[model samples]
Target: MIDPTLPLIDLHRHLDGSVRLETILDLGRQHNLPLPAMDLEGMRPYVQVTDPRPGVMAFITKFKWMVGSLVNYDACQRVAYENVEDARQEGIDYLELRFSPGFMAEPHSLDLQGVVEAVVDGVKKGTLDAGIDVNLIGILSRTYGPLAAQQELNALLHCRENITALDLAGDEANYPGELFVEHFQRARDASWQITVHAGEAAGPESVWQAIR
Candidate 1:
């Protein structure tokens, strides 16, 4: 039995952060990327947390491990493909995958644009392969400031068709929203949807500035 319509909407999610561990491990192995420093004790690794907050923190940290060794095209494709495949299994009909497409150059052989395109291509391919549709929304960490915002916005402008929106996340309490007003306006002017993470830990003011 299945309910065809329950009105499920996951408005905020982190793309690289949601990747499954086994998939990450497999890809890391294939790409020869070194994982984070987690000492293995008995059957479990010390950092393999599973108690809610710690679990989520440990989960997010895994991306650093996966990204550490990725230095070229094949690695990016592998990660994006694995992510979307997992999404399909969860009965996601419409999905928006968001990521901070930053500093994945050098060893990954990816320019920012290359990383964006690879993720988008992987989403499209995942739809056909997994029977679930996905759209990518590229993001920037506001703490990175307007210069990075402008670069992300410019990249979004160029890849407008693939990326559906622009978002600023990470460190909501310390960074001021007034700082990104200019870039957000630019993104708004360019017809990109803007959303930010606020009260998840802070207060209403963080979100207020974003929508303002």
Candidate 2:
């Protein structure tokens, strides 16, 4: 086994996925958010993979509850800050945290740009405090369709300094990367780095489409 004390690098950690469970409970309580359950064990199945899931959709559902906790700018910032802190605690030396600002803002109808800024601010503070290097990636959900993806891309472009890249995430088996080719092209035209989530939930064709 790798030594627990050794420093590591994490390139694909998701900000939403990395949120500490305790933090989610705290946010829910502070915001008076209507959660399915009030306790950690009670909320586990809703926010985590506790059962044997056969498909990607089942895996993706775990995010919905956690995403609901990010109801404000402060909530977003706290999640980002804690994400980095958790990585630091795990001995992660360099981390690239990715998240969909649109997803984080959707539950509360928060501004996408504000969400991005808050996450960036939190990451800056966390990295400083933890002595780790970190970068952020903005995600565009494939399931949200073309218009929403374009809007997300626009938001990401506007916060280029805070965001290091654009990532395509969501149901790859059903919503292929080809569906957002134009949007990805636009992101590339704006000199933004691009990464696509493919082949994990789909076959090689999904990867080919993302690359194409």
Q: Which candidate is the best by TM-score?
A: 2
Backbone Cα, N, C clashes tallied per candidate: 4, 0
Q: For candidate 2, write residues 104-166 as lDDT tens digits.
A: 888889998888889989999999899999988889988878788888878788878777788
**Cα displacement (Å) at residue 18, model 2:** 1.6
lDDT of 1 by residue, 33-91 (tens): 56653322321332334455533224444456445544665566667787777766776
Error of 2 at 181 (Å): 1.2
- Give the Å error, residue 43, model 1: 11
Instruction: Give the TM-score (vs. native) of candidate 2.
Output: 0.93
Q: Which residue segments of model 1 deviate by more than 4 Å?
A: 1-9, 36-49, 52-62, 103-109
- Give the winner by lDDT: 2
